[model samples]
Target: MASATVGVGWGWWGGAMRIPPFRTSLVVSGVLVAGLLLGGCGTGTAASEAGGGGETQGPCAASGGAVGAGAERDGVRVVGVVERAGAKESASPSGRVSERPGVSVTADSLPGVGAAGGPCAVQYDVTNPESEPFTYTITFSLVDEQGRAMSNVEETVASVGAGKTVRRTLEQAGHPAGGTLDAGRVRILDVERVPSDEAPAPAGSCPASGLRLTADQGDAAMGLRVVGLHLENCGDRAYSLEGYPVLQLLDAEHQPVDGIEVLRGTDGIPMAGGDDGPPRPVTLRPGERAVSGLAWRNTTEFGEAVTVPYVRVRAGAGADPVMVAPHLDLGTTGELGVRAWRKDETDPGAGEGGNGRPGAQGPYGGSSTS
Candidate 1:
């Protein structure tokens, strides 16, 4: 079998829905500042005893009860958690936590500083216990080596139906200052339940012509590369998209790459940014934009080179197909991965900080590949 990896790119057109990667780095940065204030002093250790007869407790000692590896609360259980280094491409499974009856949650090791020092990524597995669908938010707090919380917190929304399990990964840059994060100290700050049917109905299918696409190269490590896809609604009315886009690989001549496998986010592709919940209705008004994540690996243990020059994408079922030349070079793997569309606040379409309204350029200007 051929070794495979994934890649992503971004593009935009007139009156069309262009999907772009979400700007979670800014949120992480802001949260980091807030966390610093809430944490007061930085990680500090108390002085040792003069005679060394007894050890003095440090202020940075773990306070809150550790919640992982079989910890349960309010009908929810924490299976296990792991910490990953570098980009997710090189991430391997560790710290296995067994599943039990009732609702359970497990966190994959969150990414540390990438090779380029960008934000770390996180993936979570959430299982719903009830027969009905359940929507809730999960938050991650950075902890120091001393087992004290740091100045950074990241949260994502997740929805799982009864007896079903859903996995979600954080896309976007994360900057958790103060060295490596303590995987054991990382605990769930809150998990609020929300309405399962919160998503609004779509006005109609988004016309391909009304959407614009822009592609940009993103972070890479361990032979894995990321392409940021930005989709904007140039049409006059609102439009919505749920689920992953249909991606077909293309050769240098823009022809389909034969035997290339396209993997959906649910297929175990580690994604950054966006929520893990059921496709929420991201109703974009005229000029609003959304984002999607794409990843691919190019390294091969042993095989011929797999060259992918272009990619053709369909926003959703029945939407017109748009061809984008990401210029990705996935050598000999013949595999590409794509994530579902999520709202992006970094573009001009959605006003600076306001939701879905026209705003100023966010921390990330027009587009960012990292």
Candidate 2:
């Protein structure tokens, strides 16, 4: 008997409240709302500090720490070391439902077809470190292997900024796919916040690669340093940078010096989806922006002590090709009197005409490689 049914809500405290994740093939149910202050009137303590109606104490019992209803009676707990969110954690994306305090969940990962696995991603950090301004709500859950029920995720606005420590992402979206669920059996990750007016939205980018590398360029030579990629199209439709980028040259011991003529193409045209050339298209109009740069040259030769030469980029489309390894002091870029010969021993246009000499075009008859 396996099952699935989940629904939990809290929109700034006003409406939407339906909680149920307590199944029974083995017993699994979850609920930890923090603002109604036990109002249906059960566990005592002036009905949870007048939250039952004498009013004025519900800020989780006026923040004075353990203010009633047994502090949490012993079951729900997953805040883990958030003493101020300042120690290491970063990764963000997927948005459109926010209210910062931090934490949201609706997880799932189970026997997942034989080896055991499912559920993960339980991170949180909001930061009102303690100057005042604070709001919260964080919920996350998952259950399988006889417990019957599987998920009950929840995220309802969060705001904590007096000292600043924002870092939060919760999307384990019903986990339970197989192959041992990829071996990480996440039981039930967590986070919750409450104090509302809903305000915490900013997470979603790569909007067509609008320049974001943050600093990591290292690979040198008189040329082979293409660290300039900036494009933004936000998406409503319109994008085509064509494609023909595969520049490689790594010698000075980094190896691979065989033949040297790696320019790809520029004036002789030929530069779109190459390997055979024929489908070159470039059009962008929907908030428009595009810029490109990549050039290489280091045939290797002249003193030959170059040491770890670099520059590797391969573009076939969109984005995902980066390898810049800079580190050369070769008499400061003259390639240090280079001399490592190959490609049949130079002179194909020595000063401009020698290799295939016929008015010079000696990088091997370029017309998309005739």
Candidate 3:
């Protein structure tokens, strides 16, 4: 079953009823990730220590807690709380007992190319809830769909005391010019507070190493290849995902060898899943993942020049999709560049230009490339 959808064409998202309303208050403050290793600070780090005194606290489920069927309408899931909304909630810092408050973090800009870039920024509203003097260890990192650590930078802030909110912004850097975000591995890593003096040392173990790519047999014949992608989820909740899925390819110079913006189906339609296709409305229970395959043609004369492919996949609820473009390396090969059939261009490449894969040509067809 294809997942239900509330499509809001690119560029124009807010005006449409399909697009729900969400506040963009992502606060972040840090430079491009530093040389910290990929592993997290481990579950035993001082930062992991909780101070709520292990009290039986109110329910804090993932953003997409299962609500009654009717609660989910128009692609937006409405969750209810046993108590009044916006009730006072207390979160302790490791073991310290001070009400040093920080501002809420909200997503300000998303990464992407061709109207989509892969880099995104989360802005923070740092506030101090306590009256005494205090400091905070502000950190940022990339987490995978399964809530595993990808990378991070451990930074600090001194003297952010009671009744104040400071702002910080976190950003994923080095994204290609234009691309999509990998929705499955949307990187909404963790952001929380820890007592500055007790900040834990960085962890250096990897949950999963780098991703890998493999192409079908037809890839060679059709001159098509899959590149890399930057994943992201715009929803308040995080998603879970598996597999090292990727996008189209690019040459060594970072020039896109395949200019295909979106993948089309056999009927010349673009969607992640459809009828008899991958399951649609794949609701990756919050903080989950959903992977999709991306393919593209050469679009140019094949030669000794090497090519790299990348994609900027993006996703978010009640917000415009955030795009990130990562790349793949394809060694040199011998083939002509791919020719994308314009809305009205003659066939001039190996695969048919209609949908998914290109079509087969008739044995005796006239040659026309105008």
Per-prediction tally of clashes: 57, 39, 91
Tens digit of per-residue lDDT, candidate 1, span 220-291: 655657665667787877777777777777774446778767767634444333336555666677877777
Q: What are the runs in model 1 whose C-alpha is more than 4 Å off?
A: 1-208, 270-275, 347-370
Write the number of the candidate with greater TM-score, choosing between 1 and 3. Answer: 1
Q: For model 2, how does the per-residue alpha-carbon lDDT over 1-370 read when each residue is reduced to its tens digit?
A: 0012233211111212233433221111112211121211111122211123232321112221211211120122222111111111111212334355575543211211111111122223344444544444334454544544455554433445555544443333243422111111223443333222211211233423432211112123334322222233445775555645444455532345443344343222222112333334445555443323332334445554334344444333445443333333232123211111101122222222111111111121112221
lDDT of 3 by residue, 130-152 (tens): 56533443333334445554444
**Shift of residue 181 alpha carbon in model 2, Å:** 16
* Candidate 2 weakest ten by summed lDDT: 81-90
Error of 1 at 353 (Å): 19
Q: How well does model 2 score by local distance difference test? A: 0.29
TM-scores for every predicted model: 0.38, 0.21, 0.21
Evaluate residue 12 in candidate 3 and report its C-alpha lDDT on the 0 to 100 scale.
Answer: 9
Question: In model 2, what lDDT does residue 347 have?
Answer: 24
lDDT of each: 0.45, 0.29, 0.26
All-Cα superposition RMSD per candidate: 22.6, 21.5, 23.9
